[model samples]
Target chain A: MIDLVSDPWPLVYVGITLGVTALLAYVAKLLIWGMMRQSNPQITIAAQRLGVSIVWLVGGVVAVQELGVSIDVLLLVIGLLGVATIVALRQPLENFGAKYFADVYTPFKLGDTVRVGEHEGRVIEINAMSTVLLSKGDALVSLPNSAFLRQPVVNLTPQAWKEVVVPITLPGTMDLAAFENTMHRAIARMRVRLDRRYPPIFTVKSRTAQSTDLLLTVMVRRPEDRDPVLAEVNLRLTEAMEKAPASASRAASGASAVDPGH
Target chain B: MHSVDSRWGHDAGTAAEPREEDRDLFSDPEAATLATTAVPAEGRMNAVSVLINTQTPLLQFPRAPRGRHAMWEVESNFSRLVEGEDYRFSPGGVSRMVYPLARRMLTEGVWSDVHWVSLNSHGPEMVRLPGGITLHNVTIQPEHLGGYGKAKEAIWSTVHGLNSPRSSRDLFWTDDYGEYTYYNRVTAELIRELDLAHDFDLFYIHDFQQLPIGQMLGTIKPKLFRWHIPFDSRKIPAQWRPLISTYLNSYDVVVVSSERYRGALRRFGHRGPVRRMYPCIDPAEYKRAGPDDIGAVTTKFGIGPNDTVVLVVARMDPAKAQDRVIGAVARLLPRFPRLRLVLVGNGSFTSASSGLGIPKSRTWRRHLEETAASRGVHDRVVFTGHVSQSELESLYERCAFTVLPSVREGFGLVVVESWLYHKPTVVSVRAGIADLVTDGENGLLFDPDRPRALDRQMLRLLRDSGPLSRKLGEAGHQTARLCTLDAAVRDEVRLSGELGEN
Candidate 1:
């Protein structure tokens, strides 16, 4: 190995690679986020993080190789640790993965009375591993998120079928009010097909420094109209999400004084 | 003739001599409305920023005339244009009370700045009211205004128990309500943006038209909603319960005009505390007599010294039941032939020639005129379309008594105005202010439905009214202290501070 760990050249090479790795990881994260900002906010975050982690893992291997460390043993140890972690957290990991799908596709929301498997109650919360419900008898039930995929669920709320909630993610730099106004006007164009009483409303589900999570709720005029309204609204939402960043940037620069919503 | 009658010992019947032209109100433009005065209070209170949302603006701007360009500008510096010439103050008691409250709140240290948002399609986008108050106008399309008006009026009538709400069952599901939602949503959107900029400590929403605002605002900050109309839970339709309840629950606190309304709100299942804060005015805002106030009205309206001015202080709406007063006047004309009913309001902001463009006031005014003529008391009835606040105060001073003939009044603050001037007032039993009336002690209460009941009360007030008026007015004046802005300010500040802290 020619004493690579003690050599100045090797140490400098390792430092340069680490710098490149950080730069590459940051650029990749930004590009991925900018491209996938309209996806479910959780999914966007996970995807960007996963990409950066992969870059870090590969760069660490190269750095160790440059330092002439025992690469085979390190790989073996990392592989065993990964296997042990997966084995120990198998059920939780499955539930965690299931939560993402349920969050996107589940018909029932928090505060709705719903039935799944044998238990029924108002949904108090839905975590990564379990969906919690507060029963009428003041009991709490925690159902595995994965069970939502296997078991048939029934929503007991009035006109629950008329509701279609779409989850959207926007970058932190975007103006929420402007986005809301845009979405409102967009949804208003389909008013004839929608229930007149229930105009579309966008509620901020959660927010973070990097991104914001919002849920858009709309009511269909007929149960049969749900699918089409969802598809049409989704398209409009995607378009508005695309324009929001631009609008926000324009507003920041004082480029546009016209506010249609006002 | 002897001044004192055995039945009612009112002795001031000979104070003013009768003028024949007072019988004919056809030619006087000033009688069409009253004259004006402006006096801004100078004081200070706790420093807080407040946002008030009302469906009706304190001032209204009709479409500008063809040759003129002053009123319909996009934005106006009110200082640049005159009050009456540029824009007229809205004619209902809501605006009358709210404008002064904002003024006093701003003049005093209570609020550092006040932003009022209203539906004003014809007015400028922003108006600077005197002091730190700025009026933000939200104008909806004329096409949408009709639907908004219809839906709001439906809610108003149903809550007031004025008519059977057979049509309101479908109100939330109709296209008209869509427009109502649109207006509230737009107003809420604007409010939210303003909140972001101003970071207001409190949001005070008023009346039924903006009920949806609390929910639409979607802010967790403390919200205080005032239901200015009658709130009898039984009168609310079954279908409206869920919808109305949802909107009502959005507020941190619900304030109504009376304890009765507070109880009704509790019965209606309002989640939070229901506060009974009586809508009040600045007692000083009302002048008992300005030197020119009485003469200006007498010359303009053809009023004579001998003619007894029997006043009805309300807008020209069927809900106000000015016709009931007219009917009562017709019956009383036989005994007190010199008794003239001076009906002192034209239309509210909801009426025709307004941004809302509802024609109810014009139609109702014609109906009242027809009612008076048919009752053969046409010439004896005086119609003053609108009046300035000082002129109203002067009229309050000149009149022997005032009548709040509303079929269902939220709170007869006009009764308080009458009391402030030491003028006895006859109020309807259904009025929210009737709770304050002690029946022959402070004010008289009657039922508008029973025309004869109101007829007799008017006769007693007119026949032997002078002594009774003096006593009632004196007692009523004691009660006025309880409802003035001065009295309510401490509680308002306490409530706002409590909400802001927690």
Candidate 2:
């Protein structure tokens, strides 16, 4: 009470930093999401999360310093902890990173027969750390996720080369069935490049009120058309998402506005 | 005081009531069989939600009155046009067979919500029914509807062994096939949307026209397909096998109408559970008409007191082999001068103006009229086209016997209808119901391919009309109980409930 001027300024400064930290984090997430519209949903999510974490960390350091707490030892401890975590979890981090790439590039999926090194069986599952195979004799074969990148894996499923499976995640702002129907019509126009016997199929992996996870599968008429077909299909899918129905506003009530392509 | 003939101004005939005679057809009308036995499903775990998909909509809306609004955009209150005047319910197995099962299952507390999706080019988007049932209709563009019709017809003709192998070669790659896929995709989209909202416990799809729907759905939910037509594996082209198998394997279970078809499904390489259940009917729906009904029917058709009524109740189509029965009727008319042939029915919904509007049924009916006229029996033949349920029951009661002469039948519920009336029936060997007939006991079996065989069967029934008719009629009444709602509904509900629980 007697020295209110000095006390209120420090408290007010800390309060301002806290409020500013929240605003900065929100804006940074929006910018990251806007810049990554064309990227995979996973990458967009990761970038937004990383931006928020950085804003909070810097703002938190300043707020504590305003509170008159020494943060030198705290900064040193946090830096050392980050380095130690990277070193200790190096193997798991590699597997996790490899899983991200394998999801995008791997030709085989669950239920495909794949041969990695001397292992040969039907692929039962693909998890973060390993891929599981059920052998012909009913034995289980688990292989490391990193092995998919380290060695050449042969997919022995019949006509597997013609198959192209794309994983897609629809945001709360997009309608899945409407998006799928439009995506199918857009892809059917390129029937000359696709196998007529096998039409494009969109399968739901899982769904929530917030989002829907899906896998879009198309069979290419020729092996060489795979890359172009993928690019064209992605463009069509992104357009479908962007052109969501008006009811989509109900689902994504607080969705951000700007989306510049990644 | 009941009215006489032509109540609705349907025919230009006499309105006088016929004289009533002694009418004692059966001793016991309630001929209960073992199949009619009931089981209390107290152990059924939970109420389920079901989604049924078919090619034909259960209710077809009328084309909107000139252009007040499009039919598809109209509300389902059905105010624009009258139910019977502008549009009529489809009269065939899909409506007759599926509707009863759905209703009975709902009544028995097996389901919480039941949604049926089907193709309806001219219909409202949604219709709510009694007992928690909802109907969804999916429309395809009219420009593409013609192509869709052609593709389905080709597939139908091929599967029924009517089309030659050469015409069916590479049929799936044609331009029409693309339209067919388009129709199915739109239907799948509608169903997926409904499923997302309702979260159905199971999906029940029907027939070859909508077979690809199972594969297109890609739902991990339990899926059951009922192949309502004939399933002769040898008839399907080798080129179509791979794709057909892919569609069939997508379903958790496939149901065929006969045991022979079950064997055929296995031979067709369907790697799924195949169950053979008889197509059923509800006895309560068919009530016996009183004397006034019989009198009005006789007066309208101009039946004499001593004239024998030989009934052939079938839709006017070549597959129904109505011409074969007409031929048999001509042969018997010379010996039994009292014989009068009553052909009861018009074209099916496929031939109706509101439906797919195929002209095959109309064209075949014209051919039948020409044949009957050439055979010099047009005067003796009575074509009572499209009667009401009460009128049909009166005809069934007035008839001395019934005949089923289909060249290839999926499963003849008409035979079951005839049996329910306690009437002797002569069945075609090619019909699915022929498997249910025991040559001389419950019913007589004849080959529709051989008109003389049907002719002989007709003669035998004419000679020994008393004991033979009564015995066969009573035995048939017992057999009819097997196909009743009380029995078949049990199997149907069990299939759904167990699959849902798993």
Evaluated with TM-score, which candidate comes out highest?
Answer: 2
**Highest lDDT scorer:** 2
| DockQ-derived CAPRI band for the predicted complex in model 2 | incorrect
The list of candidate 2 runs beyond 4 A from truth reads A1-105, A127-129, A137-139, A158-262, B1-39, B43-45, B63-87, B302-307, B336-339
Q: What are the per-model numbers of colliding residue pairs?
A: 11, 0
Over the stretch B1-502, how does candidate 2's per-residue lDDT look in tens digits?
A: 0111121122243335422322222223343432233425641447778888888777665575455454435335343445554455666567677877787677667766788888777776665664666777776666667877888988888877778656786666665766777677667756766776678888999888888788778888899999988888887887677678878998999988888898888877776788888888766556667888788989988888788899988888777878887888888888998988898888765666666788888898888889899998888788888887778888899999999988778889999999988899999887777888998899999877664999888888999949999999999988886677767777786676557566
Q: Per-residue error at B119 for model 1, in Å?
A: 1.6
True contacts kept of each: 0.01, 0.06
Q: Residues A1-262, candidate 1: write the lDDT tens digits.
A: 5475466898888999999999999998888777764455456667889999999999999998988787999999999999999999999998998888888788999999999989999999998899999999999999999999889999999999988888888886676655765676677778778875565655666666576677888888899997778777766766776676432321132211112212
lDDT of 1: 0.75
